[model samples]
Target: MTPSQIAAFCLQLPGAREDLKWGSNRVFSVAGNKMFAILDFLDEGRGGLAFKVDSDLFLGYVDRPGISPAPYLARAHWIALQRPYPMGAEELRAALTRSHQLVVARLPKRLRLGLLLDPA
Candidate 1:
């Protein structure tokens, strides 16, 4: 998916927001604190996307074409594109949504509740 489309999907999650980080890269985080995804535009129709993923499913993705363990974050169960991603847009969107939920789930119970009650 295009970066804009991916960003739009990420922002649809509760408490998700965008921030620029690591120079030109764009990051998506929950509750303005925990990051779930990152986008780096390489050229027209080509870019890198990375996100947290379930430990159980991590190996399966990494074995697939164009998927790899995310730099620095892979030890924590994150997956990244080995190149400008080559995959179904829907699958990426679903992964983005799941990544957002995973980050949200790890928030402190009180904080997660607060985010859910008032996502603004």
Candidate 2:
């Protein structure tokens, strides 16, 4: 997927919101404020989308072509999936869902429950 395609995919998630925190680089975060996707590739040359993932799962995608640990966030569980991959839109959407799920799982129970109850 191209940069715009990736951003669009991220936006398809429930209550997903975009913030251009890093200048014009759009960051896709959850309703509860957890970041699950970073659509920085649009303005940052050689940029890629970052998704939260477990180490083992991170390694799986990292070993694949067009995917790697995000530059600075690798140790903290972030993976960069480049465009032009063979993965389809549904697959990417599922990955983003999983990413959001992982983040939600790590938050406090109250916060997680609050997010679940949010209408957004």
User: Candidates' lDDT values, in order?
Assistant: 0.79, 0.72
| TM-scores, one per candidate | 0.87, 0.78
The digit string of per-residue lDDT tens for model 1 on 1-120 reads: 677788788888888889888777788887666899888733223467889999999999999987888888899898878344667888787888888878887888888888882323
Off by over 4 Å in 2: 1-5, 41-47, 117-120
* Per-residue accuracy of model 2 over 13-42 as CA lDDT, tens digit each: 766788887666678887546788777644
How accurate locally is residue 35 in candidate 1, as Cα lDDT from 0 to 100?
92
Q: Count the backbone clashes (under 3 Å) in each candidate.
A: 0, 0
lDDT of 2 at 2: 73
Query: What count of clashes does model 2 give?
Result: 0
| Cα RMSD for candidates in order | 3.3, 3.3
Model 1 local distance difference test score: 0.79
- Give the runs in model 1 whose Cα sits over 4 Å from its true position: 41-46, 82-84, 117-120
Candidate 2 local Cα displacement, residue 91, angstroms: 1.8
Model 2, residue 36: C-alpha shift (Å): 0.7
